[model samples]
Target: ANQEPIHVQIRQRKGRWIGHTLRKEPSNVTQQALDWNPQGKRKRGCPKQTWKQSILDKLRTTGLTWEAAKKHANDHKKD
Candidate 1:
């Protein structure tokens, strides 16, 4: 329902999700995925970009620290 281009809309949505996840209570179900670290893994060569890393990268690209981004997301969610 937004007039924004697809890519812009996606970034906003993703940022919002990241923000929402961060704001959840520590014991929330969604928090587990964000905090999870696999017990055992040794892939060959270089490692892949992970979901957590991607979120951090996105925050960087948007010129936001995690806390700031979370606040922004929380504030905008009312709309």
Candidate 2:
């Protein structure tokens, strides 16, 4: 951390996990969550945010693009 804000630390942590999950096989639950749609959806007030959205939101705080994050997922070491 070395004096980084708490939010910064959290975002960095989540971003790494998100990137990793996105690279998993489609059969993986983490990967499926990215595009999973519920059947017979109704009674929605505000649209529910998804795990993918939360991951992207965290990556936004780090200024990383979706493509970049995907590529980063393949990196052997974290940035």
Worst 10 residues of 1 by lDDT: 70-79
Write the residue-wise lDDT of candidate 2 on 1-79 in tens digits: 3698989788678766776786788799878877886666657696667767776686687798777877877774754
For each candidate, the alpha-carbon lDDT, in order, equals 0.75, 0.74
* Global CA lDDT computed for model 1: 0.75
Model 1, 76: alpha-carbon shift in Å? 6.5
Residue 43 CA error for candidate 1 (Å)? 4.3
lDDT of 1 at 49: 58
Candidate 1 residue pairs in backbone clash: none
Which candidate wins on TM-score?
1
Tens digits of lDDT, candidate 1, 1-79: 6488999889888866787787787799887787676565668885765687788897788687867866675576454
Per-residue lDDT of 79 in model 2: 44
